[model samples]
Target: MTGRRKQGFILFRDVMHVILAIVIIVMVVFAFLSPNKYAIFFPLIFLLFSVSCLLDAIKYFKNEEHLKYSFIKATIMFILFLFMLLMSTIGFLNI
Candidate 1:
């Protein structure tokens, strides 16, 4: 049923949230301890961040009960992620 499907998606979104959080923490620590190796994981970091942004956008679209700023925040995050990704690809990051 639709309810079950929605619940499943919610569960997935929650998992993604947790995974994104962990990835961020790891990325930060790795950056501080091993800056040279951090660039190697930039692609994976980009992927995870993209997924997190996507899940937020999908959740916001599916459930409009959230505040207006929530959508704004999600949109900003998505744009920032894309910008960072593009910059990284162009060697602007230099990290």
Candidate 2:
């Protein structure tokens, strides 16, 4: 890959790391902010979800899995990745 492409990929990877970590933190913050309805379940869910996404992402890199993989797996990973990314961005800016 070109230097620029390599750098972009690296940046994206780092961004995902931040997103994954922040998703858990944000959920915890919210859960504590309102333990009655949200409880710790939401944050714990986010944490578990992010871990799964990271694992799937790792699997893709290691095994060269492609679009042919199970749609559910791909969808879960993609949605979690995007959901955490969006929530993290909003949470970071709002708080």
Candidate 3:
């Protein structure tokens, strides 16, 4: 990757990390302040984490390093995302 592209990817990854952190904080706060609403954020948290993992996988693929690890992690995250989404939609999670 070119220097500029690599920098952009780094910036994007940083932004994702920040967003993920913020989401987790919000989820925790909600869990404490309003237990009933906490489940609402479950799927969203998983989705963000899965997306982050996907971004990492893409970055690894571009750089030709740790491809298997990144892809495997992304796959796991996506599965969790899907499972959470299903549970939420089915009322099993109470979201």
Candidate 4:
């Protein structure tokens, strides 16, 4: 039962990673195609990264592995996420 549960968890994590990768790729492509609209997509990309880091932190916390490192990374990512979000909103409004 434990083995199966671990496998399931791994599968779920892999799926989430793949989805995030696809979304990031699409965002990058759109940002490149429409350079003028970078303000909108760039912040969104950071948001995704922040979420990914948060998820990693949670996983590491749960697994009792590298707690300090993961939490610190997540904290930094969240701060950057907020900064990018605020800046993008202001930029969008100005334009």
Candidate 5:
């Protein structure tokens, strides 16, 4: 991969990390402050962003040079997404 393309991928991955952190913080805050309506939305959004990150990671993986920089982040996001989905579903079911 060219230097420019590598830098771009790194930037994208870093941005995703930031987004994941912010969403998780918001998720926790909403879970504590107001668990009625908005709490569920945060998890759904989290799932969405995580899936996007995972797709990006897949792209990175498919490269001929086998860049794996984002692979760990993507896997973490996938795990988090699953957790968020399960909790959200349970919360809704209990409601």
Candidate 6:
């Protein structure tokens, strides 16, 4: 495990965090604006991201060497998981 690879991994996580935040904001806004079409798609995307985050967290945990930034990773994964649940609930209620 070279330093560059480790840095790349961290950067990738940061990128994923920003992308997920943007996605959630967009979906939430769209959900309110249309209150119809976005309601259908938001849950699907949220579920996908939540699954991805959970898998990534598993991988991070296995690599205990990077424990220093584990908190950030955990926070990001938790947010994704929560967002997924919220969106799913909203979708169910809308129906």
Pick by lDDT: which candidate is best?
A: 1
Best by TM-score: 1
lDDT of 1 by residue, 1-95 (tens): 38889899899889879989898779867867886867656655666666777777676657656876777777776686676566456553554
| TM-score of each prediction | 0.68, 0.41, 0.61, 0.59, 0.51, 0.56
Prediction 3 TM-score vs. true: 0.61
Error of 5 at 41 (Å): 2.8
Clashes of each: 0, 0, 0, 0, 0, 0
| Model 4 lDDT-worst window of ten | 55-64
Model 1 / residue 63 / CA error / Å: 1.5
Any residue pairs clashing in model 6, and if so which? Answer: none
**Candidate 2 TM-score over all chains jointly:** 0.41
Q: What does candidate 3's lDDT look like per residue over 42-89, in tens digits?
A: 656555555665565555556556555766665665566566556545
| Superposed model 3: Cα runs more than 4 Å off | 65-94
Cα deviation in Å at residue 17, candidate 5? 0.9
Q: For candidate 3, what's the RMSD?
A: 3.5
Q: Rate the local accuracy (lDDT) of all candidates.
A: 0.72, 0.62, 0.66, 0.69, 0.64, 0.71
* Candidate 1 residue pairs in clash (backbone atoms < 3 Å): none
lDDT of 3: 0.66
lDDT score at residue 9, model 1, on the 0-100 scale: 86
Task: Report the C-alpha displacement of residue 39, candidate 3, in angstroms.
Answer: 3.3
lDDT of 4 at 40: 80
Candidate 6 — which residues are off by over 4 angstroms? 48-52, 55-95
What is the lDDT, from 0 to 100, of the residue 75 in candidate 5? 63
lDDT of 5 by residue, 1-95 (tens): 78898779778777877877687777777767876766566556545565555655555554565455556665665676567667656655655
* Cα-based lDDT at residue 17, candidate 1: 97
